[model samples]
Target: MKKQRPPGLIAIVAYKAFVASLLTVTSIALLFALKNHKILENFSESYLLETKLKIIELLLDKFLIVKPKTLLFSGLAAGFYAGLTAVEALGLWYQKGWATILVLVLVGISIPPEIYELFQGLTLLKLAVFIANLAVLWYLLHHLPKHGKAD
Candidate 1:
């Protein structure tokens, strides 16, 4: 059996999961708020409401207009992230190998979009997040103990 490493990697995974969970909760809250608005009570009553109603009228219309598929995919991805994070945090909290590798993979996949956004119009918040993400990625990849597993 391989000796386990310290808890640093899982700690980072937990932090990332915490952020994703916050986003999930925020999105659900926004959906609920939109659904409960009185302006949406009778979706066919006014022109604006009718437009909204038409947008939601059919599966294809809703799929294309509201991009529910994208939302669904995002929700699923968030859930997956949370699940992976929890597994790493709780099960192998002190096991550096798997958790560290997973974090690196996640960061690798996420950085491209941040870079693309940076080229369009740089905002402080976006730049801050991108930098923070890069920092976290660097910290995890660099601090993880060298073992056969990492190769």
Candidate 2:
């Protein structure tokens, strides 16, 4: 019989679930974007609310025009990653060694990109995310059982 995991450990699993949910939503939104490319254009034309057109146009400029194939491929990739994260969450909840390995690898790989982003510009949000990731990586690496169920 296995013992219960600590609150911190469980929190990480919960975080993973939250991330998986977010990615799933993003995937759907991207797929929908393909069909609803000019939703704002259509709405403004019909609703006659074009006073703040400059702001709307500026916001639209930042968004990329995604093709159906691009959205589908991106959605599939996001879904695959979300699935991996969900599985990792489950395994971690059960105190599996392989889960730790997977998390360590994923988080470790993510650190470099995060740091690069920070160098591009420092923001409270980016700093917080980097700190959180670092803390999670540290916690899992140090606390995981030396010999536990894995593979």
Candidate 3:
């Protein structure tokens, strides 16, 4: 990684890592979705399906369809968002002034939805995400250059 200035270096790196992680996870999910399709299709018509379904039902009550097309679409959608995140992360990491504002604006936009989700259910994950976004928003506002200060 290239050298980064202090102040928000850690935050910027964390953001970059977060985006990179999403890229890796989504990429792997895409592969898993596509590769497991055949095995799932074969097992669906075999005795293995009965045993697997029993075990799965016991573990989780959720229903899942392992169709390649659906998986492909999901992966593509995730990858698309991940790509955008990557670009923003790169910009932020480099400390481009514009990137900070861009990220600030984006995070500010996301806060409303996060607040809504928190309202829907006060889960730990939702709270953490909201707080994290709030922190990012605060950090950006506090650190980013204001008005004509940008040069």
Per-candidate clashes come to: 0, 0, 0
In the order shown, what is each candidate's alpha-carbon RMSD? 7.3, 2.8, 4.1
Mind sharing the TM-score for model 3?
Answer: 0.72
- Model 3's alpha-carbon lDDT is 0.69
Which residues of candidate 3, in runs, are more than 4 Å off?
1-4, 44-46, 49-63, 66-70, 146-151
lDDT of each: 0.62, 0.79, 0.69
Candidate 3, residues 1-151, lDDT tens digits: the string is 9554665656755865696687869867776757776655555556655666777554322224545677777777778777766766777666777777777777888899888888998999889878877887887788776311243
Instruction: Look at candidate 2 and give me any clashing residue pairs.
Output: none
Better of 1 and 3 by lDDT: 3
- lDDT, candidate 1, 19-40, per-residue tens: 7677667557445534444434
lDDT of 2 by residue, 32-103 (tens): 765676774465454344566766655554444455688778888888888998998898887888888889
lDDT at 82, model 2: 87
User: How big is the positional error of residue 93 in model 2, measured in Å on the Cα after superposition?
Assistant: 0.9
Alpha-carbon runs more than 4 Å astray in model 2: 38-49, 52-58, 64-70, 146-148
